[model samples]
Target: MRVLGVDPGLTRCGIGVVDGAPGKPLRMAGVGVVRTPADADIGERLVLIERGIEAWLDEHRPQFVAVERVFSQHNVRTVMGTAQASAVALLCASRRGLPVALHTPSEVKAAVTGSGRAEKAQVGAMVTRLLRLDAPPKPADAADALALAICHIWRGTASDRLRQAVAAQRLRTPKGTA
Candidate 1:
């Protein structure tokens, strides 16, 4: 399965693509960050993000999109921008009819590293080792994007299967049944 992971932010949104199956080795298809000037109007920044996300979708044609779920932060402005960028990613995936999974930061950290509290450097090191890259991807965000993709590949697949199974069982049961 090919998965595109998005770490959404106004100033520097990270994007990464990975291809792998549940039990197979994962490969990095692409990784990059989308930058929009902080001084740029919010609308303009969103437009830039939309274009960047669309380009990635066209290029990777991922079967699934894994986006970082926006979490509450003390900085309201920062959270707002992140939520906006995340919406753009969700819209892009929806338009393409792709399955979208939202993973929390802690979930991503736990998947890539052993601990949910793993630091950035630890995540970066793990990402490098997992992808067999010569060095960690630059600008932390890029590595984070890759980590999100890797996490989905490792964790999301199982959840997807469970959901499908439940749906199938529901179909097998009578409409009035519990």
Candidate 2:
């Protein structure tokens, strides 16, 4: 499966594309950051984010999009920008009719580094090793994006299969059955 992982932020939204399946070797199709000037108006920054994400969608054509779920933070301004950028990613994927998954930062860390509280450096190192890259992707955000993709490829595929199985089983059961 091909996945585009988005680590959304107003100043530097990270974007990465990875191709893989559970128990299979992974490949890094692409990785980069979408930067918008910090001084730009909120609406303009969102527009830039939208365009950047759209371009990635056009180029990578991922089957799924995995985005970092926005969580509460002490800095309201930072959180607000993150949430806005995240919305852009969600919008872009939905417009393309692609499946989108939101994974928490801890979930991504756990998937990549075997610890929910793993440090950014650890996650970056693990991402590099997992993808067989010569070095960790820069700016922490970039590695985080790749980690999100890896996590989804490892976990989302199984979750999807389980959901399908449950639906299929329900269809097979009688309507009046519990």
Candidate 1, which ten residues in sequence have the lowest lDDT sum? 169-178
* Runs off by more than 4 Å, candidate 2: 161-178
Model 2 TM-score, all chains together:
0.89
**In order, how many clashes per candidate?**
0, 0
- Residue 166, model 1, lDDT: 54
TM-score of each: 0.89, 0.89
Candidate 1 local lDDT, 1-178, one digit each (tens): 8889999999999999999987788899999999999999999999999999999999988888899999976499899999999999988876555778999999999999989999999999999999999999989999999999999999988677554455446555555632
Q: After superposition, how far is residue 65 of candidate 1 from its true place, in Å?
A: 0.2
